[model samples]
Target: MLGLLQRCLVRQGQRSLHSGRPALMAVSSDSGVGTTQNLSESDIHQDIDKRVKKSKVVVFMKGTKEQPQCGFSNAVVQIFRMHGVDDFDTVNVLQNEGIRQGIKTYSKWPTIPQVFLDGEFIGGCDIMIQMHRSGELGETLRKAGIESQISDPPAAKDTTEETTPSTSSTNVKS
Candidate 1:
């Protein structure tokens, strides 16, 4: 049943990509039956927008936060962990091919493990890594009204004592 859904989703995604039209999603109803739903391109964008805004931090990756499938996805998970952000939402792209493609179109980004902070696109793994290294990620979280658990390093003390000026100087000719 899952395989059938995947195939349908893949075909739908392909058609949407090639024909430049909306795709039909196979939605499973409460009666344990599948039904087709007409999902427009704008609908997908709206859905993505809602999802990104649903949390302060939302990660659309290849797997869940607990078990990321791709290395890039794992890196994103670890970066969030380093910031002590444990309550963020995670959407596993591998579970739904339509979402996997839809997100790319929505964000205009060609990669997975996308990060959204307060409904704003923070970027992918490489961008996240750069932001993390530059302490921008923490600042961004702070701006988003989420405090990062990782504290800043203490300021360096001025330990250098005053030195006397040299009494003699040497001159060289070239």
Candidate 2:
């Protein structure tokens, strides 16, 4: 049954994690049936390439942009939202096991919630957080032809009112 296969896949993933190998999960083919197949590396690469180029900004996360399934994914979504990037493409890796693993292989990064700007890998959640804090993310988005909503802090204002000193005011000796 599918449940048994899923359990086996989970155990396999756990074993791969402990064995220092990339985890691999089985995914159904595009046939829309319950049948599954082993995707060739080239096929996965092609699929990932198409997805990366689907938009100016692409995110491979655990869930959709509207509803993230994990904290890291949510963080990625929030970072984009902060940048006023709402039209970016999002691939829910949780819905496709092949993509979930294939993305890691494609980017050579061992994590989920991978971000791509202009079809280039930009790293994952931690990297995104670092870029967001360092203001690099906004700049990067700008360079990618995508403007960010975050703006520079306003200059400090002088609160003191400009007024002529009264002649009657005596200067105090310090």
Candidate 3:
């Protein structure tokens, strides 16, 4: 009975995973929501790989950095801005049907605003948020040679001299 219940639960989870909400690109009417023919997987992978390798920071997003079409993408743009990162390159996935869908498969990440650092797939908005909040994002950028304008100051050194142990002992009243 327990095994049967587990199987049913797994089926429900899979159904939800397959039935995720579609990404709204807010593209021009002419584009008509993925009307462009899809490209071969190998071609798409090659293109994305080249783009990632070519740029120090590459973001596969729904729109350009100047004009992000989705809120999630916009949040990512803002995060980069906060870190004073402006040299990054962004692919407007909304412009092409092949890449729009192919990118998700390429990254195995089911979301837009995918961040790639030094040809490495970092993650999506949530992961970036966590990294920024934990101060790791700035460090990562510095290592990549992108100096952050709002970088954290170096940790302060301890300067106070150690105090000697108390020489006198207090007596307790009976």
Cα shift from native, residue 68, model 2 (Å): 0.4
Q: Write the per-residue lDDT of candidate 1 for residues 58-162, one digit (tens) a residue.
A: 898766777565567777777777788888888776656666788999999999989998888999988987877667788888888888886654455665643
Q: Give each model's whole-structure lDDT.
A: 0.71, 0.73, 0.74
Q: Taking the tens digit of each residue's C-alpha lDDT, what string does model 3 give over 1-174?
A: 224434543654454456564444354432232433465778777778888898899898876778666666776777888788988888878787687788899899998889999999999988987777767888889898889776664565665544656667889698
Candidate 2, residue 21: the lDDT equals: 33
Give TM-scores for every candidate, taking all chains together and pairing residue i with residue i. Answer: 0.66, 0.66, 0.67
Pick by lDDT: which candidate is best?
3
Clashing pairs in 1: none
Better of 1 and 3 by TM-score: 3
Question: In model 2, what are the clashing residue pairs, if there are any?
Answer: none
Residue 114 CA displacement from its true place in model 3, Å: 0.2
Clash counts for the predictions, in order: 0, 0, 0
Residue 112 in model 2: shift from native, Å?
0.3
lDDT of 1: 0.71
